[model samples]
Target: MTSASVPAAFPRAVLFDLLTALLDSWTSWNHAAGSEQAGRAWRAAYLRLTYGCGQYIAYEQLVRDAAAEVGLPESAVRSLEADWLNLTPWRGALDALRALEPHCKLAVVTNCSTRLGTQAARLFPIRWDAIVTAEEAGVYKPNARPYRLALEKLGVQANEAAFVAGSSYDMFGTAAVGLRTYWHNHVGLPLVAGAPPPEFEAPTLDSLLPWLGRFGLRPQTI
Candidate 1:
């Protein structure tokens, strides 16, 4: 893509899952738990709680509860909050976002509180068209509200945009709202049983541009 070029308009917007898709949030959790095993357990518990709870629950409270469910101490929760800013982007996240920046609208529909979602989204340095948090939507995903809220803010229908999902659990939400999804399955987690499959899945974002190209994301003349 060059300055004389622009993206085709079919996919007018690209929505992302900020925490897991864009950032290496797993590392932060691992550090907070003092071990990868404990972190995985705690994070998995957190996912189940959020996705199954349906309605809104304080995001931080869910985190603390997840820690306890996994037999982790309150100190783990303290460490997670204290080291939140230490979260970094996944490899190639910056490049992928930068490539898409001038091409189409970019937004985030993350399952987090507004404060934490805003902070995590800022790590990108890209001007997001919108950032819809679970708190704002009054429900955690795999509920459809957060994704629908983001689509509304972007002013595009579900078919006119694509969702980048970090967790397979997102398959339920995106499908419910009729949004096509591309799973950035960087962690190699298995798909959720009975969940809809994404249009594409990869260990990294390297294929995102090419995949978008298939949907008329080519460059346009000035």
Candidate 2:
């Protein structure tokens, strides 16, 4: 391809947070909790546990621990596990992804076990260029490994890529790894205190493609 046809307006690769940014794991968590109130609290606890632990830990254990911390029973954990496959894609997520696919390589950097992470990723119809899980990286997000692992797999430097973060906590890791992030704040969660802000923030993935248009020289399919 000639320089004039290169996809210069967009990064060469875009990495996404699987759980929050691409899929709606929240509904399944709430369903497992038997109420939205219980589900939200439990989910929050889980995030706290994952973000603080730094190194790898059994992801399911964290879920159970978080449930108990929020007064949920063991059954909630079971329910969540059983219903894990039911996690839905956020509205417009697929469309936005399809739009970017021709112009950029796509991948996911999620905080999940290899089993569940692979399963959750299969829910999407597209073939990912890379799928980096906490299990695979031996560390969770906000730690540099997972994000860097994805970048390594994509064969791109951090500056050559962008991250679509589902949670504000991702800002810390992505920044440390030198990847510009676009916070897909679909749930309206607050930014974590002391974390860097994302390059862009939106309630839905619809804005992702448009925001990406502002970068690089001119976009052509990669």
Candidate 3:
């Protein structure tokens, strides 16, 4: 959709996907694994396991399992898991979050377990309105349950919230539940087949700031 086609008012709340959207966890995995290919494989393996199980698994355990699947040593797996404790924010992620915080409610709805989600939040200080993990919802993204739960927690209708996702898979899930989606397409990946396209797209978290004006958002004085 064109920028002018965007709604004139911002959603009452903003839901964010935690892993890649807010934190640079993939880069940490790549550094620990010593190759980008291996890091991608590990993430793929982790998603396969998470979806295959149809339930929440702690991200650290998922990391260990992915390490095993990718034939990484125990030491490397440990390092990868430890990296979650101090995940680096994507460039301009914190600034973007800070800018948006006062304008609307902000929440994180992630595929991670509650422990990992909490740890990630501590690493980056934002007063989130809600933090919903798959573990709490008893299901993962693309399932509809977690997204619905997030909407419930935020006390907003689907149309009254916007979901910002780092992956097309997540965009599909968020859109399926009828929330406006903004895809953070840092890698220039094509949209996933069989899923609806996101309502908005940007190369980085900071790129979304200027576009918020289309939603009629203004900085609020706390």
Q: State the lDDT of candidate 3 residue by residue for 105-169, as single tens digits.
A: 88899888788777787777778889999889988887788889989988988877888888788
Candidate 3 clash figure, as a count: 0
Error of 3 at 51 (Å): 3.6
Top-down lDDT ranking:
2, 1, 3
TM-score of 1: 0.93
Instruction: Please give the CA lDDT of all the candidate structures.
Output: 0.88, 0.89, 0.78
Q: Compare candidates 1 and 3 on lDDT and give the better one.
A: 1
lDDT (Cα) of model 2: 0.89
For each candidate, give its TM-score against the true structure.
Answer: 0.93, 0.93, 0.87
Candidate 3's C-alpha runs over 4 A off are 1-8, 216-222
Lowest summed lDDT across 10 adjacent residues in model 3 is found at: 213-222
* Model 2 Cα shift for residue 125 (angstroms): 0.7
lDDT, candidate 2, 67-173, per-residue tens:
98998999999999999888999999998888888889999999999999999999989989999999999998889999888988999999889899999999999
